[model samples]
Target: MSQRSIKITMSAVLLAAATLASTAPAGAAHGGEPLTDVRVATHFDLAAGQMPENITLLPDGTAAVTFAAGRQVALVSPGGGTRILATLPAPADGGVHTPVLGFPLTTGIARTPDGTVYVLYATGTADLTGLWRLRPGQDPQRIAALPADGLPNGLALDAHGRTLYITDSVLGTVWTVPTTGGTPTAWSTASELAPTGFLGANGAKVRGGALWVTNLDRGTLLRIPIRSGNRAGAPQVKASGMAGIDDFAFTGRGNEVLAALNAPNTVVRIRPDGTSTTVLDAADGLQNPTSVALRGKDVYVLSAAYTTAADPNLLRAHLRGHR
Candidate 1:
């Protein structure tokens, strides 16, 4: 769905600024405990339509990000350099047929060690909505065809990188496709993945033989085990009460995670027990934070400024007490 849609849905539950101030303690005023050194690493040109939607980090500290509204993928370096990689061609009708959001958008992204980048595009048209693969120097190619009626939102590669799993927010399904590209399989259609009104199954990741996903409208984190013979076990809701959560990254500390709460303009650290704490908020320059990534001790956050419509940028923070 659109940012305006999210803002309207989240307005009632937005954490008040006064509540945040009252919760501040000695050393964690701006950023809550276990998060520090928060700062903007790069300020994207919002006027140029450079709002980042999802991110994947390379080994060299560079980030491959999908510009949701721009229908483009670009790389951002640690030192704040930016480079446009490729722009997906617009549909003949200019995405007028696009689903819920009413426009074509690039969503989740995942990169392999060999530099093969796979990203998702949703134009609500059969000819252009699906998963696209981009080799080092080749133009982006549609590898798999997804349903035009569904909103393909999140993308992830499995443990061996042999399979790609996708989340369709509108359809409330999880689709699996081979890395080489082919027809997608509706791997799971759990009711938990259904959207309340806006969107569902927003962000996804595969780890520990299970696929982890977030439902934006339901405000819940779900895990579906990858059982033997490539079957999907029953889904389990791991966490809830986080409205507007867009995307998340595992903290490498067991099941701990850092998740971006989009309309709330906050990033939170969720513990294994399902409890969450506000790690970074608007005070740290978060403007509709879309995704979170972790590279060693650094925490990378992409703010699309979708609702705020100002300061679309990337912020980095230090993860304290991270062993």
Candidate 2:
């Protein structure tokens, strides 16, 4: 990336962070009841110099995390132990540098039932932008190439696991590729997906027979019906008014979801009826929560804590009262 582009990108991200800091409430409490039994599972200080961004839990009770600054994929054992699973090649310039904080690169990850892992990264270089997959004992393989301007940030897989959906934050476009390997096609590109600045669609998922995505800049959650022949129906807003929405996960209820509000460091629960409530916030000690994952009755959150990467964390909280 050129110096001019880097300046523009950094300014946008800084502005978003500043906006959240200025407007968000300082305390931990929100209107709704807070989530229960919140605990820290892992802290980045142990993985020194690494900034953990996104996570995908493996079937064997371990989590695969993408270290945006460390440039690697690591497995976090249930006991809080972490080890590098695969080291991705360093991207050009290794992403932009910001004082005190870490780079804003390499953010999303997903795993197939068969143990295959998919990662999204942007190096501001043509050949290094898009999704890559790592099979057991195999090297990282580029599955598809996104546009040069694409900033791929979140990933999701369909029910049959035949298709993979990726969200591009910079371009506000969603691309789909066959899980087993095929041409990546533009799945959706409506006006609703347009980027307001640097963030457009940040996180995506397939649940309850439809494709759901979050617009980080718009503060809206959009639902698009998955029609016959793998096509997308007209998009509709499911929920909005969120701040710095990054990634989200379903709560296993009808249409309820948990979202990470990065700027203010909060997690919110959104219902199918479009109502939202804070489930966790700064009072809960959350700092730049980037993504949320659920396993059984427990919810896991990964925080980037952009203010300083020294203590970014992985937190666990009990799932409660979602019907």
Candidate 3:
């Protein structure tokens, strides 16, 4: 089957599951307090290929985002002004060699305090498949080489900004590389990161001395400790039952997180105890929320509209008393 067909089939299955889950009694599938003042901050141009796949926040409150299909990196200011920072070169065959998705796309992104940006690109070809770095006033450069056959998805930077942890969905592996860029090391290949039939290891973050990741196919959140020698320890299941989960953000209140459920068209708050509740849904302008980022009480969500085929937008909301 074609990639598009596979995506549609997966969406249908996940949508049905979400529908049933949504009907569950309160505090069961939906438990946490929903967000407030949810509003669209910016509506992207679908025709122009401006679907945002992932996002990272800058100190100035601007969001650095990767336009997945467009293969571009852009900055959206707090006031909703957008500026294209860089666009990756298109593959000669127009990404026909790409795996899984069968098309070239940018995925996870992270920014450093010094204005350096790192993003992941998957093309199923060696030349342009790996991590890219963009320094202030300079063009983007491919830093490390990843497996052409694997789909590199979510990314996270350690607290000191000296290391980068990347998740490969197709390979069911977590890779570690220096921020400066070099050969990547297979950090972990736990069974939990493996995909059941579709994508896995979708979103990743580093916090509290641990690397947290989400498995889309497994519908789980996993935590792997940063053991001695900067190695990955045993994988621990943090949360489960959230099918179609994409990217997530730490709410800073312990292990509480707001995760985007792509095909389900919702954002859920998952607590440390594995309980989760619907915090935002399609009514909040989410067309297939791909990622979430939080700054203080402010929340940002990027919806790609991949399956919805409607509005791909950036949404802002308040967490209501969250510091």
RMSD of every prediction: 4.2, 4.0, 2.9
Q: Which runs of model 1 end up more than 4 angstroms from their true locations?
A: 1-32
Index of the highest-lDDT prediction: 3
Q: On TM-score, who's better, 1 or 3?
A: 3
When 1 and 3 are scored with lDDT, the better candidate is 3
* Candidate 3 overall lDDT versus native: 0.87
**What would the TM-score be for candidate 2 when compared with the true structure?**
0.88
lDDT of 3 by residue, 70-124 (tens): 8899999999988999999888877867766767889999988888999999988
lDDT of 1 by residue, 135-249 (tens): 9889999999999999998998998889999999999999999999999999999999998766778899998889999988777899899999789899999988777778999
Q: Model 1, 108: alpha-carbon shift in Å?
A: 0.7
Ranking by lDDT: 3, 1, 2
Candidate 2, residues 223-284, lDDT tens digits: the string is 98889998988889998777578788887887888888887668888878887777787767
- True-vs-predicted CA distance for residue 201, candidate 1, Å: 0.8
TM-score per prediction, in order, is 0.91, 0.88, 0.93
